[model samples]
Target: MFQTDSENDSAEPHYLRLRNQIANEIEAGILSSGARLPSERKYHELIGSARGTVREALSQLEAEGLIYRKDRSGWYVSPKPVTYDPTRWSGFMTYVAEQGRLPATETLQVKTEKQPPAILDIFGKGVRNPLYRVERRRSIDERPVLVEDITINPALAPGLARHNLNGSLSGVLRDVYGLVVTRNHVEMRACALVRHTAECLGVKSGTPGLLVIRTSYDARGRVIEYDQEYWCANAIRIEVDLTVA
Candidate 1:
């Protein structure tokens, strides 16, 4: 289905032609989500195009969010990204579950570390003592979607590490520590996945992704948690709602 003829007299650029052909296939449902694409060499051979042309075509598709690449594996059609509303007070698991998707968390590492300058800057006296650092990989319906690095003030929840860390941190804070999160200051940006993040998310380094930095505050206006979350660009769609008085 991907084969192209060299003698075809199309005026379009080679890469554009290839990209459009692949896009048409995806649109027609000939290539479904999660379907692995042909290897670069195979695609080049099938289309009789230059290797660079095939690579460029695939890269374009990836940028358009139609395809994704794994580290050692080739490209695959991407599933529809999940919709997320940062303004909502709901936690990740709750929101994902509401969307009819199963959400799971795997605790990768947990330790106490000296508060970084950035964290200290955000929390100041609130984070004066050593911070409890937790790295977790979050998945939806068995597909890894994001990784989060969370820092907490140990003083607020002593012996927190002894409890199950795979569950909701927000739930733990509210139920166990009696710290109800009342507000979140969030900052979002588009970024490429770094090596470690990419490895954790099963994507190639430099893959396009979203970065969210969140500072959670308790009812008393004390910073309770600082969270850095990296999400696959193809796996999330962010939405915001505003009302004016």
Candidate 2:
């Protein structure tokens, strides 16, 4: 059931009343996580408000991290954020599972291509050197949350093209290629999701998103892998533990 702005809610913005009502329901578990909300028209009709007012209220909730919009799909109550620690050398499956969530990965593309100019500069490789590139979409609890494009130095992981990439690449590198990510350099920023990446992650293009670029090094300090990951802005909670020397 929805409520209209009564005497108690008279002083506040109409949308805020709706936003608060929805948020209260979510916090009280009336609207469970991953639950789809009513369509804009339905919501507005229920509340006896304009569609624009309903939309504004939903936008406020989204900005508060209580809900999210899926491209071509209706809004949903955001699931618990997956905590990510960039300093840890861990696999996607590992962290997701640790949080009691199901993790799935879909391989989007695999190819051997001439080293990209940026990759070449990082790897210090010849222009002719071919790198193995893999693009993947990863999901938690059936919601696509990340799209990652990764380039691997073929010289470091021979026969990598033959492995099943739908699983953890970190696992494959460790078990098959005998390579370990001893150290890594990670950079993160807020960005507008590109069309292709947004589509892959099931979000609207130009949505504010999180970008993480990581370069992994082997024990010998060789650049083993470079990857860029695009994430749904509300789908993850980045947490890092630090100790001062």
Candidate 3:
């Protein structure tokens, strides 16, 4: 059984004391990343607190990005976040490998979709274009990180649907269609994961996450692709380097 410091016993809530203890152990590397934690029942027994108190402490740790709960699997220490540079054109696989982490992608669904009104606005009003919709989930070190829904202008890359999408679509565009991304417009916002995406990432629905919307354009300024990505909040860190004029 664990005991709180006598000085803290009177000053802090039981759950806060538990949270601080675990957080300190994690920061001190006593609890290594990816290590599964003791069950709530076990923790409460060890700490001499209610199971609900232990659960609340775990929830706090998760919100602070120090831990995660894998459905059916118990809590685990969160891995160090992957740094992502929104300004860089380097693809996901390349960057992830550069950081000495394994990157993986799974193509979930691929279909030819009629231009929805929002899509038509981007492709051009009243343009009857065939858009390819692709759904994918990406992981690092076998832990699911993000899910993306992509819209591709098949007219820009003929036979795009025929190609395997389990890899980088940017590579497919460059190698197969001879098109390279020259410009991108990116927007980010905090969101709650919807049901489908939440399931894909192995998180509960309505879990807090980050949404990244990207529209890629070629040198001639045509919108080739638009994708929306829902990222596990603790799994990634955004970094951008800029040059001063």
Q: Cα RMSD to native, each candidate? A: 3.5, 3.3, 3.0
1 versus 3: better TM-score goes to: 3
Best-to-worst order by TM-score is 3, 2, 1
Per-residue lDDT tens digits of candidate 1, residues 1-245? Answer: 66576566878889888899989988888889789988899888888999999999998998989987776788989876788998888888898999988899999999999876877887766467578999999999899999999998888999988888898999998899999888899999999998999999988788889998999998788888899999998889999989996
> What is candidate 2's lDDT per residue for 1-245, written digit by digit as tens?
87754534477888899898899999899999989988998888788888889999999998877898777699999997799998776778998999999999999888888865767888764434778889999999998999998988887788787889888898898899898888899999988887899888767688778898999888777877898899888888889888898
Per-residue lDDT of model 3, residues 83-130, tens digit only: 989988778899998999999999999888886687778866435667
| lDDT (C-alpha) at residue 85 in model 1 | 94
Worst 10 residues of 3 by lDDT: 1-10
Best by lDDT: 1
Q: What's the C-alpha lDDT at position 206 in model 3?
A: 84
Instruction: Name the TM-score of candidate 2.
Output: 0.81
Clashes counted in candidate 2 amount to 0
lDDT of each: 0.88, 0.86, 0.86
lDDT of residue 113 for candidate 1: 90
